[model samples]
Target: MTLAKSSELGITHLPDHTELPESDGTFVKNFQEHPQSLLLTDSITDVLQQLHPDHQFAIGQDCGIYWRLTEPPEKGAEAPDWFYVPNVPPMLNGKFRRSYVLWQEYVAPLIVLEFVSGDGSEERDKTPLTGKFWVYEQAIRVPFYGIYEFSKASVEVYHLVDGKYQLLPANERGHYSIPPMGVELGIWQGQYKNMTAPWLRWWDTQGNLLLSSDEKSQQLTSQLEEVSSQLEQEQEKAERLAEKLRQMGIDPDQL
Candidate 1:
């Protein structure tokens, strides 16, 4: 919403996160949106932590980023499916931020991602002031903007260069490099939370898929199981050797 205003008296003060409306009274376009947002956030958290050792970073999921003042505050904001702003505290004054106010915090989001629910028109709209593309590139000036279409199993990434959006070409491994975080953005076909589909995911610059916390745990468990099985096999082999030595009339323990 607009700043704390005074109509009777000529006075106005930019409202902080607390004074803004958190939502725009709109329904999430589809069911996949929530899980998709979480998948992106869950997978890249470690990278973000390492990038911001002070833990001064914020990731917003379907959260509003207010760029300008408007009659109905939500109109002035664009709520991306996912976004990451670097070097900002996860909270403001020990309280969760209801919305990201750009005027209050001059730092722009490093990247903003939009998941396509329809024909992808909205995500690519470049109409000045109101269009999502224009708002992100011109107003918010998010350095990296991605439009992902799960049904198509593809994403189009744009990098802002020289005050214009430039389509970024994928590297040899078909991923877009985000140098700031030492990671790449790409689509992966896999199972997440029991759903098998093409998901928008992150990878290291070297083309290693970034695993979520659950995936990491599962990997550790598998490794432990393998190690235990090897130990058992080695123990059995040693016992067999001892028996053979005894049969040969040699004290197995003496060796």
Candidate 2:
């Protein structure tokens, strides 16, 4: 997807600054406790680094959110599993965050992700929880919503069309394109963190797969080990040739 398909994107209109609450360290602590969200969170963090290395965006990692509602502070809806504001700094002046303040971030997240793991009921975690999606797409007007079934290895992406969230079908490669994020959310049938599932993956706007940090590290390590083994073989061959020449009554080095 390209920007040509978009109307006036309101990204530039919003103020680029964000505000933090006064020393509420509880939210960050709670967010880090959820280990299941790590896969999605780490993948997203890697993508952010590649797309905007200089922290040229505002991102949330399963942290606090400020919903667009006038509800009581305790009753207001929460932040998403993961979200990003492309036009804001990745960090607040080279620092990490624990919560997001809506009053400061006037703009909506360009894309939001929900890893489908709500209830501690069963292996599938089939607890009823989708009200958040409506709140985000309909109430908050987030441009895109990405839902991933971590257990089933599936993804369904939706886009806001005429103020309605319309589900976008998978492409030829089972990837759903998100026009707002400049990337496609897809399930890659591969191994990640030693588990094999349809992993939530990031692809460029052109549909090319973006390599996660772990993946890139694995690739580079494999290449270096290959080179090392080849060097060892060469050294072995050279030693054998030198020994043969000595046996044939000539010091190869002197010759």
Candidate 3:
């Protein structure tokens, strides 16, 4: 799986998403990863929609981001567990992207999050070319990188500053603020999809937890029920007043 040879063709050439290998044949490291990715994507979907009214945004869950050309095409790509790239259409050329080819898109993701499955060494590695941290900060130049560890119930975010990554300090709510997105990233201990544990989640800058589609639906249903109950109570009170007027020999309907 080699890239097209520019020299043999006598013209500079770069492969697009369609030509890239979407996977490296590696198994998912843990069971928690899939759900964690979904939770993050689900919770932030509304925010992304609001941010990109034109619907020009992409959210990749365990999808490869091709950064370079290598012998095995997959080697050049790093598939963050979860990532968000703004201003790019969710699909490419009327087709969903098989993978994000940086050479073609030329848009780095706004944020790349890696869920730490092992000792967290790979996520934090700084070795040139091969390390995740180096690939993100030095090559891809992603503005924000998050390393989340569910076992530790913790997350550490780094903001690319002056060609280096700076550890962002958590605010009063113990959440890292991504000002550009108008949201904060943090860990919340709760049940999502019936799995109870510390899950990485998002919040607004005002420290409000961003609800997922399911959570929002539940909230709306509860509010509607409460409103219906109050309306019924008011109707009963009106009937009771009419009865009192009738007992006093007053024409309640005419009044």
Candidate 4:
């Protein structure tokens, strides 16, 4: 089924940004208790910012996404663990975004990521018109939807094809490439934020893993230390050669 635009769907009245409700109090109860979820979300946002230093984008974690065609703007909304809407200002009216209103922005999220918490049922729910899966697939029509299982270190990506969410095949490196964002999503087993576990991470188009701020610092420090050590080795070798020449009755400094 081809998805209908807001105009075709009889959503003639678009609410202004000020008319939309920022918070519906749905994300108040331990919304993001999992530490990995927070880490992964922050890591993705950081890497994206570093990659596109000039691009403007809005990223939200546990932030309500207000999307409705005919009903009130805030009637039903989904708060994905992480969502990205490119080309939109990160803030609205010089203020940090409290939520994303589709009609007001006139752009749906390009990518939405959900980190599986309790049972994987909700993340995979496909009930028509009411389920989160249906809302993203049919209502909001997000381009890419990703479900990540932290415990199993698995990632499932779905691309919107013909108005339906279709599972995408992974590349050789077991990552799903997001063409619009020029990045790939995959699981990496490593230490982040002092916690060692399998974490979801982003990679560049060339499959280079995006490093967090701390990781980048560590890599640069390592490179500098290696250069310093190599210089010391070269200096010692030159001194030894000069000493041998001097012992053979040649003034190495004058030569």
Candidate 5:
């Protein structure tokens, strides 16, 4: 479908050039109350943070988006699995957060990704308040919406264009990219944290898989060590050659 006019859509895309939360405690509490639901919910937070590193994301977090309903939901809401209000800070309070508290930030996440907890991901990956065909298009108004099924290793990505959510075309690798985030999202078939099966992983600007913070650090360290060792070996070889030349009564320094 043809994209809507800029005036009609009212979306101002931010340039990419311009651009951690401890959920263990809350998980335990919410787990006792609703174990299965909490897992999916917590997973959303992790994924959202990874997917959209440029924006502040929160799970069970109320958004400051314009709610056409008579009034916004509760101030401190335990709402959806994950939601992002763009143009917000990247830090989180040490303790629990009551809803997203959008007023304080005056922004919301541009994208939100939710995971299916149970009962067929098709069912769990729905937002009735939002239209069926275009849920994020109508209700959440997030630029991009991603729904994932942990068990099935299924995923769907949607982008906001012409004031509507447009399904992103996947490549051979079953991947999609977001202009705002300057990254791509795809199903990675492998193990993560001991879990087998495909899991979501981040990619760098060059499309290289972005290793976890620890992995990246270790890789750089190893590279440095390798270079250092090579340099040492080269120096030793040069010294030996020069010593041999000197022993032969040759002016090694001149040579």
Candidate 6:
């Protein structure tokens, strides 16, 4: 389906490129208490980059998503913990994107992820016209909305159906399928970025875990070591056979 342009959506006059607020000072935050949020975001971005080497997609971490061009940044924006916009250049013009302005981009995010911090009410707030859930569901109408609570080690996925968000049930492996991304979202228990905890991770449609760069490197290293060890054992067995043949009064190299 063709998405409506900003002018078609009642935003007749596009704001001057220079007048758009790129950074509303919302990107900067103290992550000491919630460092996992950064780790999860970075890991997902890295994995997707590996998964789709040729595609250029925008992945934002704690960056403002300005849904309305007519409204000011303060009233029209929401900064998700992580968001993915497919088929878009990671940069705007030639510079890094400071904020995702929906009207200018003409594409809403395919999926938005909110890592539950503090009391977790803000992530699930459903107050109309004000709540994060409401904005993503009604205003932006994102396809998939995920709420991950690290404290409970749970993930809640909501799919937009009939202009409302419907909770989705996990599959047999306890993952929510995200068709647009061609991956599944699930909680993984492991150490990432040196922190041992449950992390929201992505899996292939076949249920294979998508690894970060470091994890991929480690996996390759492990496979190489296993092959080397098998080679060494074979070499030792060949030497043993040669020694036994020599003891039997025959030149081992003749055959």
Residue 145 error, candidate 5, Å: 0.6
C-alpha displacement of 46 in model 6, angstroms? 8.0
Model 5 per-residue lDDT at 111: 63
Residue 166's lDDT within candidate 3 is 100
- TM-scores of the candidates are 0.94, 0.68, 0.91, 0.84, 0.59, 0.84
Candidates ranked, most accurate by TM-score first: 1, 3, 6, 4, 2, 5
| lDDT score for residue 214 of model 2 | 81
Off by over 4 Å in 2: 1-36, 44-47, 91-98, 118-130, 179-182, 189-191, 194-198, 204-212
lDDT of 1 by residue, 1-255 (tens): 223344433437777889989999988568788888888999999888898889999999988999877767788899998999999989989999999999888899999999998899999999988899999999888999999998899999999999899999999999999888899999899899879899999999879999988899999999999999999999999999999999999999998
Identify the runs in model 1 with alpha carbons over 4 angstroms from their true place.
Answer: 1-11
Q: What lDDT tens digits, residue by residue, belong to model 2 across residues 1-255?
A: 001111233233322223323232343334222443565555566666677778677767566565532212323345566777876766665667556555555567888777666441321222222256656755567788777776677777778889877889888777887664566778777766666666677787787777666877888999999999999999999999999999999898997
Clashes of 2: 3
For each candidate, the alpha-carbon lDDT, in order, equals 0.90, 0.62, 0.91, 0.78, 0.52, 0.78
Which 10-residue span in candidate 2 carries the lowest summed lDDT?
A: 1-10
Between candidates 1 and 5, the one scoring higher on TM-score is 1
Q: Count the backbone clashes (under 3 Å) in each candidate.
A: 1, 3, 0, 0, 6, 0
Error of 5 at 241 (Å): 0.9
* Cα lDDT tens digits for candidate 5, 28-108: 123222332333344344445766577555444322232221112221122344455544445544544433433344454
In terms of TM-score, which candidate is stronger, 2 or 5? 2
Query: Which ranges in model 4 have alpha carbons more than 4 Å from their true place?
Result: 1-54, 69-75
Tens-digit per-residue lDDT, 9-99, candidate 3 = 4545677898888899988668899888888889888888899999999999889999878767788899999999999989999999999
Candidate number of the best lDDT: 3
How does model 1 score by TM-score? 0.94
TM-score of 5: 0.59
